[model samples]
Target: MVDRCSLEKEYILSPELKFKSEIQQLNNLPKAKKEFPRLSEVPSQVLQQTIKQLHKGWEYFQKRGFGAPRFKKFGQFKSLLFPQFQENPVTNLHVKLPKIGAIPINLHRPIPTGFMVKQVRILRKADKWYASISLQCDVSVPDPMPHGHPIGVDVGLEKFLATSDGVLVKPPKFFKQLQSKLKLLQRRLSRKKKRSKNYEKQRLQVARLHHKIDNTRKDFHYKQAHALCDAGDMVFMEDLDYRITAKGMFGKQMLDAAFGQFRSIVKYVCWKRGKFFSTVDAKGTSQQCPECGEEVKKDLSVRIHDCPHCKYKTDRDVAAGQNIRNRGIKLISTVGQMGKETACADELPGAGVIQSRQVSQPRQGKTRKPKK
Candidate 1:
């Protein structure tokens, strides 16, 4: 369909101006199935969905003014989406799809008590095939109310993350650990003739290694996110575009750390665990002293935060985390009934104002009792 659209004189004149609907009309034509016999093998909805996916890319490109839609090369298209289902297609041990018969699957985790399977997307990663099922439950769950301990988080390439409570996590360079092996595989692959069986086998080996690195990094992110939620009821992170950081000298390390993915996972986990999550302004988080609230300028080389005004010293990341926590608390206090919900007495000052000049004393908050 993309090729056909590209050949159109109007599309060549202004590709950005065209949309998915125009191509969709061609997909609906009876001649489409005649031209592409393979189209008839899959369900009609799946074929239409393929066009929708392309349209989504085109739409995004129009809005972002970059990332124009491009055709997928051979073997690049790896997923088939069955968008809607009249009934649950998943059984105890297999998932049923239209046109395609039941395929046995090792169910990772059972669907929740009330959720109904709504859609299924079958994806291929290297040599493994997997089904990603989406479920729907007709229930409205309110967002977790701001309460209990509020903790701030600061993430970087050096330390995976530092919390306001003085907890530091080191980055686990998953890629770097296996990079040598990956390079070895690529070198072997380059020696093989293109399109040969040996080359294909070698290519799959390399792809699987890359997939392993991705899975390992993502698993680490989830574990860390859960750890953060376990520490505090309210989690606050700095709202910085890690993408900008990814273009710098240490871009490879930044990419390996995957700060943005970690933050997003943290937010999702916080919501799932009935905790409050938010992002505070990222500006000057490192420059301002958490103790005295005075601007103390420092270079990237300076890892320790030393405040002259208050004679306070601590890890720079931890201080930044503290600032993030303070800002988040202030934000909620002004917008909602934070005083009524929050259990901390020291934090309660003149109209929710945090006294940065005073020495902060750590007080053990009442451990939140679980609901019956």
Candidate 2:
């Protein structure tokens, strides 16, 4: 359906008109069944949902600058979504589908009584089948705002995370730990004949290993994010461009660090817990001296920030965190003043603040002429 719509839209010229035409054509069951016999077996609602999804993708591409929707291969289309689930008979450990009957579901946790099941999506991962159920419920009580210390965090490959309070977090390199085992599995799989039973089994083994690594990394990130949210009322961090950074010399390391995932988790967790979360410009956060605001140019090898001007010495990551904190405070203060709500660094009880120092010129080195 997506392919047909995409092809028709090319000749139609107007997307709006093409979408309308497609909807009308899809709604006509008699014509649709004659054209595509498979449409007769599938529920009308599911087919319409697929068309709706295709239209949404095109709309997103046009309005939000998203990538154009592409054709999905047999295995690539791994999920079937039912926007509305029938609620005639509800079972504790089973879900009824249109074509497929009630499938057994492993209920790890019980759902709330008042919540209504809105949608059901069945996904296939490797050989395992899983159901993602969306639920909606009314909220009578609002969650209280998070109240705690305000801290700035700096994340990097070396330390994983460094905070303004002089705390450092080391990331568990899940992929790195299993790299050798994964390589062995992959090599063994490559040696097996394609499409053979042994090849399929080896492929599943490799996929399972990859899934385990992904889950482990995600678990680590979630725990760290939750801890930070629970500990801090206002969390500040640098707004980094992961795409640009991932193309550098240490691209592999950058990707392995999963900085983007960490930031996303932190942001969402903060939102959920009613904590203040903001990002500051990352430009000079690391290079600038937190004490005097002097640019202390140094290479990546410089782990310690030794400011020549103010004679300030500290761990590079900690200094960066302090700088980020200061910037965040300034930003909040400015915004608050503009809105006539005087917000100060002192308002955040346990927030760390950097003392300003007078900038001093560094001693210049003598220039030497090249020996000819």
Residue 174 miss distance in model 2 (angstroms): 1.6
Q: For candidate 2, write residues 150-242 as lDDT tens digits.
A: 668899988888877676777667889899999999999999998888998999999889888878888888888877765567789999889
Among all windows of 10 consecutive residues in model 1, the one with the lowest summed lDDT is 363-372
* TM-score of each model, paired residue for residue: 0.86, 0.79
Off by over 4 Å in 1: 1-29, 64-66, 336-372
Model 2: number of clashes? Answer: 0
What's the true lDDT of residue 349 in model 2?
39
State in Å the error of residue 28, model 1. Answer: 3.0
C-alpha RMSD for every candidate: 5.6, 9.3
What would the TM-score be for candidate 2 when compared with the true structure? Answer: 0.79
| lDDT for predicted candidate 1 compared with the true structure | 0.81
Q: Write down the lDDT of every candidate, Cα atoms only.
A: 0.81, 0.75
